[model samples]
Target: MRVLWKIEMWCRKQAAAAILPLLLVGWLTGESSQALTTFGKSNTQPPKEVAPTAPPARPCSRQAECAGISSSSCVRTHYDSVTRCLCGDNSPPLNGQCEAQSKLLYHVCANSDECNDGLVCGAPNITGNAQPHLRVLTPQDKICLCDTESGYREREYTCSDAEILKTSIFAIIFVTSLRKILFY
Candidate 1:
């Protein structure tokens, strides 16, 4: 009888252990479900994004006040005598903001005329592995550099021109010396 009673107690303990957790879980789940239903449905759409506002304009007497603003300068309004900070074209423009002119890259040419004074449209003067393998994009594409053999042609000066240049130099020197002597 004692052995049977011990077995019965063990069965009750096992049943309590298994059933307690299940009951707790069910109770917790029901409570959560009720809370969710009462809370109503959540918004499915994403929150709208707001644009960042520009910094407020400030009073200024010089360009120093507009130093932080990109492409900004100091100007005095006709209505107001005090100078104010205004965003406009700045020298070379910060980060290329505003309608600023872009500088040309070395050896890269958009047109023959765009090249340096002596450079013309033709094959590039680059040597070794650095030479470009692909064809130029522009029909008259040429690197702006001194490459007399391929692109740039040397200006020819006649003997008469050389003599004229020498004569002009001598004349300038003579006139400068005469002026100095007379003034002294």
Candidate 2:
């Protein structure tokens, strides 16, 4: 009789656990869906379409002709034999302009913004050292480096100036300690 009571109590607890979650989820879902339906029904009108904007004008014949345009100055560029006045070198890239190249190695970066528009800032994950050592990169060591598959195929990581000095000092100390271990 005691064993039967224990089994019944365990079954009841298990059933309660299983049913409680289902009940809670159903109640929450019903409330949310009711609220969503009420909100959605009130906004029955279709969204209005907006006209597309035109790009900034690039109008010039001579290199000196484009000096008055906003956010862009004058520069001479040759395309297929015609030398014409175009946007200057310092102009920020336009909406459809392609990115120039991947981020160069060892360019100092605090975050992704300091790097080029698309490149991330991080070091490579290197292995295969004679001595197994764990390495943790600080904020300084994180430079404006390209992702691995973005044609930046350097096996080793690039470091900032401060990181270089710190790493070199640590390397010297570690080598000397290894030598002492070998000699003793």
Off by over 4 Å in 2: 1-160
lDDT of 2 by residue, 46-66 (tens): 898988664433534332343
Q: After the best TM-score superposition of candidate 1, give how far the Cα of residue 42 lies from its true spot, in angstroms.
A: 78
The TM-score of candidate 2 is 0.19
Which regions in candidate 1 have their CA more than 4 angstroms from the true location?
1-105, 129-141, 147-176, 179-184
lDDT of 1 by residue, 104-137 (tens): 2223344566543444445443444432321222
Question: Any residue pairs clashing in model 1, and if so which?
Answer: none
Relative to the true structure, candidate 1 has a C-alpha RMSD (angstroms) of 35.6
Highest-scoring model, TM-score = 1
How does model 1 score by TM-score? 0.23
**111 in model 2: Cα distance from truth in Å?**
15
Model 1 lowest lDDT segment of ten: 130-139
Q: Give the distance in Å from residue 48's predicted Cα in candidate 2 to where it truly belongs.
A: 53
